[model samples]
Target: MFLKVIKHKTAWLAVLAACLSACNTGNSNRPTDTPTSGTIHISVDETYEPLIEAELKVFHSLYPNTHIIADYKPEAECFKDLLNDSARLIIATRELNAQENAYFKQIKISPRSMLLAWDALALVTNRENPDSILTMDQVRNIMDGTDKERKWQIVFDNPNSSTVRYIRDSLNKGKPLPPNTMAAKTNPEVVDYVARNKAAIGVIGVNWISDPNDSTSIEFTNKVTVVKVRADYGSEFVKPYQAYIATGSYQLKRGCFFVLREPYRGLGTGFATFLGSYEGQLVIKRFRLFPARINAVFREANIQ
Candidate 1:
């Protein structure tokens, strides 16, 4: 009897020692997996910062555990960040060019891109100005500096921006824009410049004139008026309205892109998916930009 009791006690001690050893060694016989949580770094162009910031806030609310760090820079610099592997994702107004794609491929990083939404390039003038419309030819002449007379005062959003490129491309067709047109350092500067100068016409993104029901929009409209661009005779010169863009009436529209490194997994894939989701599309619509996917069913149902 004594021997059996002693054996039982020794067996219990051995089992407890094995369990404690496993715990102390930080090795479990069962499968052990750790949860992943980290910050996602995103670099975006200044042109799309406002919309991106708003979208990020909503994203954060849904993903409370994950953190996002956003860096806003010019489109050129944002691309540089991606090339340097400093950013996981890049949001910009334009897609990567052939040379950029080649660079990524050379570096063993094939880029994946998604078109999030379409934004229009707006031509604006002081509210006090009587002219409310402009033709593409007139705009082209001003941008190309071929007008010579400077009859139509022209201003660019920024010196190194797609806005300037658009103006140059649209006006020059294949040539280059003249050096006479004014290039502002920032979007607000362009807006202020046009607001103060009645003769000047400022070119900027349609996102600047967002918020139809807000005080900012009212104030902007009161100070400056958006110009209507006419592409043809039957097609009336229309402002950059959401409906107009959705119907393909706006001729100078550009698609916003989500550019990321290859494999398209992790943060890059997640961010792109969110941007293309219904909630993200609605956010774009709220910013007065046109979503790539048209929700015709929702539109018709919402229509009273």
Candidate 2:
């Protein structure tokens, strides 16, 4: 009986030792990155470069110890970075689909995503272009390859950009872009192309030309004419103004989202949180995009 009791106690001691070892190992494996310090890599859709750049500037100033390296590319490549574990966070126009969530689940990493803002695509043309207004039907015709006359040369920032995807999915009904559509390396390039071309209309994020505080954006705005769009043949034309974006009056509106795969409350989480905070939403408002996380009232009044 004495021998059996001793054996049982020894077995219990071994199990307790193993459990303690595992607990210590798990504690050691905790991520080193934190909200106020540590470095992180994030991917952002290039269309949002200006907006994100401004946001990062403020973030870095507030949290001087934290560093975030951002890779600006097409929305598709941003997703690739997140899936391959090269980036801890990604800013894009849409959230992950069912497949993406499942893949994260399989990897034992539950990703989180939040809507940051309501963004719109602006159609900009050369100052010399006489046609500065378009109906949704006309825009659809241009995108679906039905405009045989090819009245305008359609330009996009990139073939794989979120702008292209938005048009294809929302306007073209999943159909591919027209063969004659032109793609520039960046939004600025697209604006330059349109500024120089007589018949080119560049599709770009509203933020690129909407920021009055940004000298580059003002220069681009001066170089091209922002086209006013109407939802239908008989509707009123409207530019992608903040009030219009908030009220869904802008025809090319889409939601901006940040998808994070951070394993802890790291720098990525800090930055993501900032994007939805009051200060961050103020930045978004300054850029003329509609903030999703903040409340703002719009009233109709006639201008003098």
Best by TM-score: 2
Tens digit per residue, CA lDDT, model 1, 89-149: 8988888898888887787877888888888888889888877777766666767766654
Residue 139 in model 1: lDDT: 63
Q: Candidates' lDDT values, in order?
A: 0.76, 0.91
| Per-residue lDDT of 168 in model 2 | 96
RMSD for each of the candidates: 7.0, 5.8
The segments of candidate 1 whose C-alpha lies over 4 angstroms from its true place after superposition are 1-37, 148-150, 213-215, 262-264, 296-304
Q: Which stretches of candidate 2 lie over 4 Å from their true place?
A: 1-30, 148-150
Candidate 2 TM-score versus the reference: 0.89
